[model samples]
Target chain A: MGELRLMKGNEVLAEAAIRCGCDGYFGYPITPQSEVMETLMARQPWEETGMVVLQAESEVAAINMIYGAAATGKKVMTSSSSPGISLMSEGISYIAGSELPCLIINVQRGGPGLGTIQPSQADYFQAVKGGGHGDYKLIVLAPSSVQEMNDFVDLAFELAFKYRNPAMILTDGAIGQMMEKVELADFKPRWTNDELIEKCGSWATTGKPAGRKPNIITSLEMDSAKMEANNKRFQEKYRKMEEEEPRYEALMCDDAEYVIVAFGTSSRVCQKAIELARAKGVKVGLLRPITLYPFPKKAIAELSCRIKGFLSVEMSAGQMIEDIKLSVFEGGCIVPVKFFGRLGGIIPSPGEVVKALEENFLKG
Target chain B: MDIKDIIKPENLVYKKSELLIDTIMHYCPGCSHGVVHKILSEVIDEMGIQEKTIGIAPVGCAVFAYNYIDIDWQEAAHGRAPAVATGVVRLNPDNIVFAYQGDGDLASIGTAEIIHACNRGENIVVIFINNGIYGMTGGQMAPTTLVGQVTSTTPAGRNVDLNGYPMKITELIAQLPGTSYVTRQSVQTAAAVRKCKRSIKKAFQNVIDKKGTSFVEVVSTCNAGWKMTPVGANKWMEENMFPFYPLGDMKDSDKKEVSNN
Candidate 1:
């Protein structure tokens, strides 16, 4: 087994980035996620793995840095919280438009405008529905535990480069701050310059050699027909991801009449709520969505055929519930899809979730 | 002699830089951007660094700079070219990186990005074109717009109370310790054009020597934005612009005696 150690979710993200052979990390410190850069700084990964870590002036600068580095065909990333992520939205859009591969981590905090420092999943709409302005989608991965935090780094980079699209780890303040045992992956050597040319030379902005045309990474297309074609190409990519990338976990769903749809910290709470409801003779199960963008719509559609209803529990004012409802509707099922959420960073307990499920889906 | 014989190789005294593509530029006639693009491409060719050079194209007229220069390039969002260059050069130290930006992009919307990238001593070259007005957006007033100069946004001429004074950002950049070389030059005359070319070449060499951020501010003219003929704009710039934004080497780490102007 790999080396196991107790670490905070944010810290494990840093360790995982280094162990996974990330070439560079550019970030601006924000609360609840500052440890991501702090841990990297303290470890001095440049000394060990030749990784370059820099504290950018702002989220705008950090995200643009990711754009530049990613254009050069390097594994680059950045991390921030809600407000910072908002600042990065424009740069993120540019990155998406340019079709560069990179990772962005948003350890979410409450916000309509700097709402609170505590955990909230309100950025769901922003993360999965093209956070930046464009006809594009980020491959959003929701991690519930510190272990998933450690695992998703490599996985996100893998998927990002595979599709030449941006990927994000949509975690929260709770998981970012909480300490848990994580098994760190082995040190993977960074791709050499020769390997980079072999893999990304087709499009990446590596310096042009003689006999080859210069590689220009840009999103601007003055021709309307060309721009529309690019947009269609992007939509095709998202559709491919939807078909091949949706990941979900269904617990006790085989025999359940009522299912609770949740993700991240909320999903963990639903697992406990499942046990509580089962003990009380209520047949409830949990359907946890791990990839929020390429959401488990098919799984929910299949479950909608037999399930009585779906109760989406979240830490925001009913965001994921919309997706669940859409799934049920797409499945052509006439089942009730309900939402239960605590807004402004309040996480619901198992008993509270069970009560919400019963009040929304049960009771004559 | 036949026309073909006159056009033979021996008769040709000069040719366009091979690094420049054959595509026609969209820049307006007499716009300094074309001249700057020509000189930059010539520098890359002369230095034989075309294969090891990367460029960051900023928003504005120069956004299509990658189309003209035959080198690897990443087009940056408005005013964020410096930060993008930081990322490119830091990861690939062996590659020479440079950012091309206009006044509105560098001095206004992207102020934070430019200042911080310079302060961090990123090993890259910055080609800052200051024409004192936003040319691509129909001559809007820029942060570098001179006081009492009339722009589309300032039809009654810029006022000190409402619009603030013109910013000398090159002077500010020179003060940053992280910067190894800072110079302000123009391309209005043949002699000035030669001097500007030398300055650009020097900036690129600094990157090779591992010197920190090298900034070259080209005091340029936007004839259409200025609402004047090409010849009139040149005369106007020499008379008014030269006083405030003087042409000289402001700072150089290699020389102990640094000139303020």
Candidate 2:
């Protein structure tokens, strides 16, 4: 087994990427997540692991670099915060529409603009829902701890290639900057680009020969009928993924009367709220989404029958709450729903969530 | 046979390798992209890195560079090849990485990426095409376009006061401590073509030897964008452009030391 070490989420992410033999990394320097680049640069990964690391001019260029490398079926990735992710939308859409498999990390910060340097999960809609244009979805994994940083690197690669889709780790500044002991896997899998070329060769631009079948890597579908067919294929694949990959962690939901809905750092906050609310003789429990896209609807919908209401507490301006509401009982049931959130990296204290839990569920 | 006559197929003189993308050329009849692509592809073939090489295309005429390169090709936003190339080279240092850009893409928009990459001493090859005009966006005043040169946007002529003087990217980058070699050559006539090829080879070699950022600026002509006959454009560059953007080694670390000794 590999040695255990205390590492920040960003550092763990950098190490995990190299350990997994990522083909390339493209990123610009920004606070909170700057440690990702600093860590890679400090390690001289190129010299050590023959890993590629580049400090791009802007987040826009960095994502496009990922776009360039990902086109070759090479395991590639990029990381940015909210504002930078906003700049990366166009390229993200292109990569998705191109049907390329790659990983993207967003150490989320506050904002609809350059919101704040502090941690925020306000990009929930952008991460889970489609932020960029086109009918495409990225498999979003939310890691609450540094240990998950190592596990998610392998998982993101697995899901990316498995679904021919882009995967994102929607972490935040708190997780990115926080240091924690992480368990590393012992097994090392050496990935070769040629193997990917052989597997993903049907469409990859790996230098097709003359007089052979011409291959095109484009999202541009000029023909209406062809586009319709492509969309149908995408929808079918998404449905299959949703069935196979619903991941989440639930606590005491079996006997609880009220469910607290959250993900990422906000979920961690709600966990504390759950503990306090229980001590105060309240029957509130927490539901944390690990995979935000294939949302944990099964457990949530089941709990809707037993619970009085669902408190959707988030770090964003009520983004994931919509998913929670839509997932459990849809619009039919008056299974009451309420939201509490703080935008632009200002997190609601567990006291706030506990207070809301008391006022909304316990009192009623 | 000097390893040149191993192939049995009579129609193909070289190895039966797919090192070039099979596609139609969108460049004008006399644009230098085709020639430069030929030379680059030849080098890629000779080096036997078809599977382990990646190329970044600029936003100019070569935006669809993925269409021409056989191995792996990525298109960068205009002037961002170095940034993209940095990402690729950093992730897989074993792979041969290069970025191709035109004047507008390199000297104008991508200036930050190239300069910072050089300053940081990134081991990537940057092939800058100085065609004296923005070929992809139609002819406009360029960083390399000389004073008094009339481009479409310039109308009557490029005014020094209004447009400022031409920019020398190679000379500027060569001064940086991070850059080991910065060369300026043209791909015009046969002799110039030889020099241009040499610079590219040298830049690739620098990357192989783990030298810092290797920059090669190739002065070329955009006949269509300049609204001149291909031959006239070549002549214009020779007479008017070459004086401002003088050809030859701007700075080479080893060459400088050798000459000093």
Candidate 3:
């Protein structure tokens, strides 16, 4: 820990990026997440850490910029909201296809198109399933609190480079705007050229040295046979990630009969809902998925054997319930999975979630 | 002198650049891409920056540009080369960065990227090839297509009402305050090739000087796309394309005053 400071989630992310030796940040402003860039501009990381902070023309440009910087084996990141992230979908595919390691922070707002500035977890499907084209997946870290927002910034970068894939901090407006006291991590220095060459010399284009062929970073494989082989390699990497990286937390699930699967803000609400449900003798527990892609399927399936039913609490009408269904059914033990949610910036209260759980899952 | 003796270093008048690979270019015989590629490699080799230069290849005909240019390269999505170059140069400011794009990639789909990159005055070079048609996709009308030009898309010569006027993108770029140098050149004739090479060198040199957004637009010809013989296409480009996209330096902030008009 470096210093304890009260900070907003978006601001904490910016601070963590600078302290984590982020080499560059390229982004365009959108609602509910503009502070990420605003804070970086205010901090003037260029002077402090020699990090390059640029306000890109648009989200499309920003993501492609990440692709370029990451090609050089540098730590670069970008921040956007729902609409901006959608615009960056094409570039994100390119980044994923090229297998560049970088961080993207999506402080999600309500969507379908310019829906609202308030918080929503509607982007769960897009983040976990790969928002862009092709068979790919971003290592998504869902941060529910301001502290987690601060912590996940470093973790996301770590996982990104560990697997040589793009990582996303899938947060929402509530976490981005709220403030909390956080113990900041110690600062790390940016990697020197020699260090980059040592670590990423196999793939990164850090300028060709004598006696070696030039490194070309591109996703284009015109030959269909070769392209299929490349995709198989990516699939193998994704499978390894799934085995090693599925993360989640089970609260009060040791002897519970009914369970609630949630994440981000909804998980916080579920925390309160569990207290309410337990007092009413419902014996409900909460399973908060931290990594949405390498989804805690094994944990959820194991719980399904013990629990009577599961209620998926979410900010959207129902996005993550599909994954819950997949997990519960994987073991041939089909427990009734219900969804209680709101949409378009609507935040369900603890009382509402508890009532819905009782009416939907606990009644029978 | 014997044949072997005549091939001595002192007697040799010209040799291809080592920076260019021996692989055959996919371009047609008289297409300007090969000529342009050769000149670019020549400049990089002569400037002794081959090892330090990083090139961004666009998604047009020259997407395989990395195959020929023996330097660190990145192949960008169509029209995203400038945005990609922006990232490359910002992170690796010590290296020479440039993007090779055709009209369709730069002027049509990627117009905003190029404009904003130029406006921001990013310290990178842009090599734009205006062949009045999309060559790789086969004979489609490009944004730089001449008025009253015939193409697969504009079968009945381009009409302003239906297709709008051809974009004079180089002239528009020269007006941006961020651009330090802007020139429109061609490589149809031997003399023209020499001038075009000079323009390319100046563009690269401007980046070394830390001057922002040096743009070199080459009024090239797509012989196959234009439905003409290689020799005829060169002559036609001289007559038709030059009048619209004239050859010469449009702006040079290092030498003359620039207006952000």
Candidate 4:
């Protein structure tokens, strides 16, 4: 509650980055998310806070830049859409392998291959599952509103540095382009050189002092035994994250028989859909997942015991519903799990969601 | 005098650079990489910048460069060393940054990264090793492989129609306005090795002075990949490689000042 302003999601993201003391931003322009770099350029954060803003030659270069800076234990970030993120996957895998902390924002558009520039949630599997070559996890956060977009920048950095892993704001074109009132955070000073050394001196690639050994940041381990040991350490950290990080918002779940599961913009639609379903004397609830990787599995599993069925509403072709079914199965519940989605950048409406739930679950 | 008296401190004439660790290098016998690495370590030790230098190791035979050079390092993905060095230098401008890359890593898959990094005029050093063939991943045709060179991928000698011609990437790099110094040198002889060392020192000095990109290409040999003996490889390189990839400075911003003065 530092200051209030009406801004686009992309602009708020850039402003929040400066306010949160981000060290650098390296990005390439892609439609539906170009405003992110555009806004950073217009703000001239370099003049104000010494934040390094660079328009890289391509997404591949941008992500590698993030890798280099993050190895020095700096709060660096990049933003892009689906195709651009795909280009960054190789670097992302390297970043993950090196166990460096950084932030990535994907304002996703529809895509099998540059499918559309409009809103879509088609990257859920790619984000939650491993999109790159190796077995690694990116702490994924889904923000449904412009306010959350402004807030998640700081939160993502905090969690990333806490775990020494990459974190991503898995948003979409709808929230990226839409305008809303956001309460911005207060300005925090960027870390001084002394502070950076104090925080990251143990593992970061800051220059070696006279008394210490050189720090080498690499992912290549020639020996299979050592490589397996490194993989085990990564998996252990992910398990701790799964135990401590799953977040969700449960709406009217006290006495509902059926629940609508969604995230990001689709979750907003389900909120309205819940009201429509209730007015028709149908008992419905909403379970909105905020962290997609440390998914709200426990909550969904608990809900499976009481709810008659779950309708996973998404803007893709039945991707998240598989997770819902898995949650129910893990919870030892035999409840029905169904999916309703719109593909190719089409956002499902409240009325359409209500109709889909009735036709898929209640009718059967 | 006794042999023990000759080995005393006062009689010492040469010793290994302290900047190089005791770890044995994995480079093949008579490989040019070993010579270049030794020279680089000596330069860093001479300048006393070991505590302030950060090196980017590219994906090739030099991937384990961090093991040999006692300095902070980041191992970049294939062809991404320039981009990674850009990240390090922009954020930590006080540190001397450099990228060590191979022919395949720089001239082919990473063409875009090297070109854009130089064009942006990033204040960093680029050490390019052009052996004209891929040595780490078996003997394959490299972007800098000579037109008539025979490799695993080009067994019948490179066909102009299929493999195109050897890339003169250093010449392209010299054309970029962001570059302040660009040179091509070799390591076939003791005199040539000294010359290459001078060029590398100059490149590092340029970066320290905040001059734009400094590039030094060392035309090298790969005996195992070339299917020749160590001595034979050096003779073959002098006979064929030198004529195509001639040694000498291609561009020097400092020369402009000397000429003007």
C-alpha-based local distance difference test score of model 4: 0.94
Candidate 2: tens digits of C-alpha lDDT, residues B1-261: 655665556746544235565677778988888778877887777766566666777777877766776766666655667766766566556677888888898898778778887887878888888998888777988888887888888887888888888898888788888887888888778788767878888888888888888888888889998888989989988888788778878778777452210
Model 4 residue runs over 4 Å out of place are B257-261
User: What DockQ do you compute for every candidate structure?
Assistant: 0.91, 0.23, 0.82, 0.89
- Top DockQ hit: 1
**Candidate number with the higher TM-score (3 or 4):** 4
lDDT of each: 0.95, 0.80, 0.92, 0.94
True-contact fraction per candidate equals 0.89, 0.31, 0.75, 0.86
Candidate 3 structure quality by residue, lDDT tens digits, A69-156: 9998999999999999999999999999999999999999998899999999999989999998999999999988888998898899
Question: Which 10 consecutive positions of candidate 4 chain B have the poorest summed lDDT?
Answer: B252-261
Q: Candidate 4 chain A — worst ten consecutive residues by lDDT sum? A: A355-364
Question: What TM-score does model 3 achieve against the real structure?
Answer: 0.98
Of the two candidates 1 and 3, the one with more favorable DockQ, higher being better, is: 1
Q: Residues B123-238, candidate 4: write the lDDT tens digits.
A: 99999999999999998999999998999999999888998999999999998999999999999899999999999999999998999899999999999999999999999999
* Cα shift from native, residue A316, model 4 (Å): 0.5
Error of 3 at B108 (Å): 1.1
Report lDDT (Cα) of residue A256, candidate 1: 99
Q: List model 1 lDDT by residue over A23-53, tens digit each.
A: 9999999998999999999999999999999
Instruction: Compose the digit string of candidate 3's lDDT tens values, residues B1-261.
Output: 689989889988788998998999988889899999999999999998877899999999999999998999999988999999999999999889999999999999999999999999999999999999999998999988888999999999999999999999988898899999998899998999999999999999999989999999999999999999999999999899888888888899877655332
